[model samples]
Target: MKAYLDIETSSDGRITVVGMYRPSKDLKQLVLPNITSQEILDFLNDAEAIVTYNGDRFDLPVIYKHLGLDLMGCFKSLDLMYDCWEHNLYGGLKKVEKKLGIHRDLPDMNGYDAVKLWSKYETRSDRKALEVLLKYNEEDVLNLCILEELLKAKKVED
Candidate 1:
């Protein structure tokens, strides 16, 4: 089974939320300071592979920095961004999504927006901001799944 993962962090690098998408399961968001590290690990342990965009350089490092868990070799990783580079495809996740015609609910949302939403939640206890951030995160992971499928189909065709 594959797990699609994404994380949202504060400016100082504290993780605010971690989202996971697995087949046949509802998208799960672990809200930091409320959820335990062990809980996150338990969820990840079930997956044979983890899928993400730029995860090797960004998401995985941030997860290790905050959780103190070295995920290297824990499971096979499918880094879509790295695959794109290998094929000479350039641009970040959003740009690649556009190139592939993968639609997202919030086209303007980005990591900075996630940070701002986190800040709003932190300062004023804004539930809506947190909800929006979770939604953004959910889309991120789901889109990774879409991209993975596309890549797999292309590989088969080749």
Candidate 2:
């Protein structure tokens, strides 16, 4: 099975796992405090392939830093960023939308925005930031699935 994951991390290294999705299934929100390093390892162990929007550059590295787990050697990881970058398309997450032909009304929120969101949450104790962060993370993981479908179709064409 394929598992799609996206993470939101604070500048100080706290991670909130946003979402996980499998084929024929809707995305699910995972409680951040309930996650552990071993659980991530277990998910990587079970998944035949893993998909993410910008996982290689950001998500996986952050997870490795926080959890002391390096997934580089463990699973088949597909990073949409690398594929886009290979074509000289440096545009980050929005590239996924254009490449996959998916429409989402997400604001121009990126990881930097996530950092700012956490900052606001910490400084002002604003719960809305947390909710926005979760929604941002959820879109990221779901976008992975959409990109995967586009990739598979291109492979067939090739």
Q: Which stretches of candidate 1 lie over 4 Å from their true place?
A: none
TM-score for each candidate, following the candidate numbering:
0.93, 0.78
Task: Put down candidate 1 lDDT per residue, 30-74, tens digits, no spaces.
Answer: 997865668777888778888889998998888887777766568
Q: Which candidate leads in lDDT?
A: 1
Global CA lDDT computed for model 2: 0.72
Stretches of candidate 2 exceeding 4 Å from the true structure: 24-34, 42-45, 85-89
Residues 75-141, candidate 2: write the lDDT tens digits: 7888877766654546777665765577665657777887898778778978998788778877788
TM-score of 2: 0.78
User: Ten-residue segment with the worst summed lDDT in candidate 2?
Assistant: 23-32
What local lDDT score does residue 115 receive in model 2, on the 0 to 100 scale?
A: 84
Each prediction's RMSD over C-alphas, in Å, is 1.4, 2.7
List the global CA lDDT of all models: 0.85, 0.72
